[model samples]
Target: MKLGLVIDLDTCVGCHACAVACKQWNTSGTTGPLTDYDPYGENPAGVWFNRIRSYEVDDYPNNKTVNTPMSCMHCDDAACVTVCPTGASYKREEDGIVLVDQSKCMGCNLCAWACPYGARELDEDSGVMKKCTLCVDRIYDEALPVEERQPACVMTCPTSARFFGDFDDPNSEVSTLVRERSGYAMMPEVGYNPVNKYLPPRQRPKAPTIEKKEAATGQTLIGKWMKRQKDAFNDFGKGAR
Candidate 1:
């Protein structure tokens, strides 16, 4: 099954909740105790499986802010796996999840450089690479409730902006969302065929403009006050000129 995520960019609020949840769950999970260096220092840094970045689209007045949460894409043609000299980086044939074998990793940094999405990070503490495992340990556990079997990020998203499902199934929620919302994969030109899809923000309806009426012969107090303020502003501009 081609399992992956469908992230609704329109709904993401840049809260970084998903990132925090991923870090919290994975820290003690299959890849426990992710490294953190100088966390409280001026240059705080750490390894994280997910990251949220916000960008403003268009110019000031008409601009929109887009919040993007990124992680391993689990691509069909995963360059990271192909570039790993040691057979440490591999994709699961059953679920399409890309995982790095910490034992086989030699801290070569080759896979990191080869990955276009910057999803892999070197754990200086372990001297190996790590990435998003799609919470494999949690998802496959029969002990956990089926509803709670999704990735930590997907489970903790406050806005419900994230979705996890099998993308190969035509009727799957992920696939249906992609078809209906015109969801797209990032950097498709890179030819990795990333399984993760992003749903673009929906178009907003424009507000109806109020038609201006002719000023009445007798003005109300508020209108007169507004007129006075407008005249003062015009006078100030004239004086400045």
Candidate 2:
């Protein structure tokens, strides 16, 4: 089953909630206690499974903001898995989730370099690579509610922009969204064939416009005020003469 995410670019508000939620859950997850260096210092940096970026579409009045949250694409031709020197990073055949076996990992930065999406991060505390596992542990756990058994990012997205499902199943939600919304893979030209898809922003509805005055008989408050000012100026001119 090719399981993955369908992210809607139109609805994503770029709140970074998905990133924070992913960090929170994964910190204590199977491969974590994800490290932070100088967290409180001037140069704070840490390992994160997700990152959000905002970009402006145009200039000034016509500008539109696009918020993109990126993580492991879990590509069908995963470069990270192929470049793993110790065979630590691998993609699961069952669900297509890319993961690193921390035990086998040698803290080599090769996988990170191979990935074009910059999905992988080196956990300094564990001295191994870390990335999104699609919350594999949570998804398979029978204890959690069926509805809640999604990735932390999907669950916490306020805009409901992130959707997780089996991409192999044509009837699945992700597949349906992809087909209906014209979802697309990032950097398909690179040939990684990323499993995750991104739905482009929907066309915005045009703003309602006020109708032009037909005869200009009705005077507005502002127009009346302007007329009064004009009348006063005329009277002042007459008195001056």
Candidate 3:
């Protein structure tokens, strides 16, 4: 079904809400208790599934900030899966979600090195590799409400920038948004054919400029107020003298 995410870059505000949510939910999920080393210390580090990166586009006056939240792309030609010697990393045939079996992992670090997107991380505590699982445990659970069966990141995004659905379905929201917004895959030249898509920032509408003829004269409210302030200051200065 090619289940994946379609992120809207235009609406994302670099809040890191998705990253926080992913960490919170997945810590106690199927891949529970993600490792954290020196969280309160100077060199705080942890195994995080989602990461938010912001880049400044263009230069100076015309510059814009682009916030990109990245995780496992679940590529069609997933190199992470191919590189795993013990078959620890594998992609699901039914949904195209990439997952790491911690039990089978041998702390080889091959999959982490092979991943071009830096989506995989080694859990030193468990001596195994960890990555985004698309919240498979939550999505397929019958106990949860139907509408609440999305990934933690998708559910917690405050701006509604994240969407999750089957990319293979033409009628799905992900597919429709991809078609309408001209969404694109990251680093397509790498040939991984990532399922996750990102919608580019839309061009902002320019503010209408006031022509010279439409400029406010001295009789305008603001001009008159300024004139009154000047006169008051001059009178105060004369009285002080």
**Whose TM-score is higher: candidate 1's or candidate 2's?**
1
lDDT of 3 by residue, 128-232 (tens): 999999999999999999999999999999999999999889999999999999999999999999999999999986546544332234477777676677557
Pairs that clash in candidate 3: none
Per-residue accuracy of model 2 over 1-241 as CA lDDT, tens digit each: 9989999999999999999999899989997877788889998789999999997775433457899999999999998999898999999877889999998999989999999998999988779899998998899989999999999999999999999999999999999999999999988998999999999998886556554343223388666666677556445434343
Where model 3 places Cα greater than 4 Å from the true spot, the runs are: 206-241
Q: CA lDDT of each candidate?
A: 0.90, 0.89, 0.90
Please give, for residues 53-155, the per-residue lDDT of candidate 1 as tens digits. Answer: 9877764335678999999999999999999999999999999999998889999999999888989999998899999999999999999999999999999
Of the two candidates 1 and 2, the one with more favorable lDDT, higher being better, is: 1
Name the regions of candidate 1 deviating beyond 4 angstroms. 207-241
- Order of models, best TM-score first: 1, 3, 2
Clash number by candidate, in order: 0, 0, 0
Query: What shift in Å separates residue 40 of candidate 1 from its native position after superposition?
Result: 3.6
TM-score of 2: 0.84
**TM-score to native of every candidate shown:** 0.85, 0.84, 0.85
Error of 2 at 59 (Å): 3.9
Off by over 4 Å in 2: 206-241
Lowest summed lDDT over 10 consecutive residues: which window, candidate 3? 209-218
